[model samples]
Target: MDSSDREVRDVNNILFGGFTELFCLFLFLVSAFFPNSLLAGDLVEQWTGKHTRIAWVQDQGNGLDTYGRSPDLMLYGYDSQDGRGARPLLTQKSNFFKPLITP
Candidate 1:
């Protein structure tokens, strides 16, 4: 209500904002310094296979079309990098070393 009260509120807001900015900077620094090498460890274990599938499908919208870009430009997804042909790899029970997983 009063100028003094307003000033105090402003000070509190500034302090809170500064703290938030500093916290964000600290988080950015931490993430930048520390690599997430272990984040894909589980997936890496699954990918440790005796065979790697090669994908072959339609144009991934990387080419030029009559309009401008290909209408088939692949939409982003969990398997965006993989083509339609990669379904077999995902559907298969053991994409890894079959001998070890099966026997």
Candidate 2:
């Protein structure tokens, strides 16, 4: 109504808008770092006797097309990086680790 009241309202609106924008940006940033906790199904049984780590990367769309639907690349190797009888084992892509995994 009055000039003073209008000025105060405008300032309040500006502050609110800025806060909303900041909160949204913060949430976006947080989500970028969040892990994709969802997996298609249980591969635990298939993982028997194999020592591996499953890395779930959250898609921040940072210029790389991480083929999300593609099968996970399983890298099998010795338990130790460099030690006695420690060596990186390579497997064929098609019949992969059939000899290693199977007894």
Candidate 3:
């Protein structure tokens, strides 16, 4: 084929690839924004194992250093039956504050 024909084919290929990528990205974003409508009882039960309550705690700063603040902590617990007692399953500490070291 001639040089001009090859150039046109290349341009068309690039445009088609870009459009496909953009369409996939748009679909993902739309799905993420929509509320979850499916029932997740089985999944929740399998993960949490029976009756469980997740607790999250936010440590309020003393108002001394407004820039550097600690993140909130998350805790998971499981309690079964009447007055069975609560058991802590997992605990995690997150860092939502500004990092001390520069990237």
| Per-prediction backbone clash count | 0, 0, 0
Candidate 3 lDDT tens digits, 1-103: 6797688668867867676456335433433443231223233334446643332233344534332345543332222222322223345555444322211
Question: Model 3, which residues run further than 4 Å from truth?
Answer: 1-15, 35-103
Best by TM-score: 1
Find the 10 residues in a row with the least total lDDT in model 2: 36-45
Clashing pairs in 3: none
Which digits, one per residue and each the tens of the lDDT, describe model 1 over residues 10-76? 8867867676456335433433443343322223234433222222222345454322234443221
Better of 1 and 2 by TM-score: 1
Query: Which ranges in model 2 have alpha carbons more than 4 Å from their true place?
Result: 1-12, 36-103
lDDT of 2: 0.34
Instruction: Give candidate 1 misplaced runs (Cα > 4 Å).
Output: 1-15, 37-103
Decoy 3 TM-score against native: 0.22
lDDT score, residue 29, model 2?
Answer: 42
- The best candidate by lDDT is 3
Q: Please give me the total number of clashing residue pairs in predicted model 1.
A: 0
lDDT of 1 at 103: 16
lDDT of each: 0.35, 0.34, 0.39
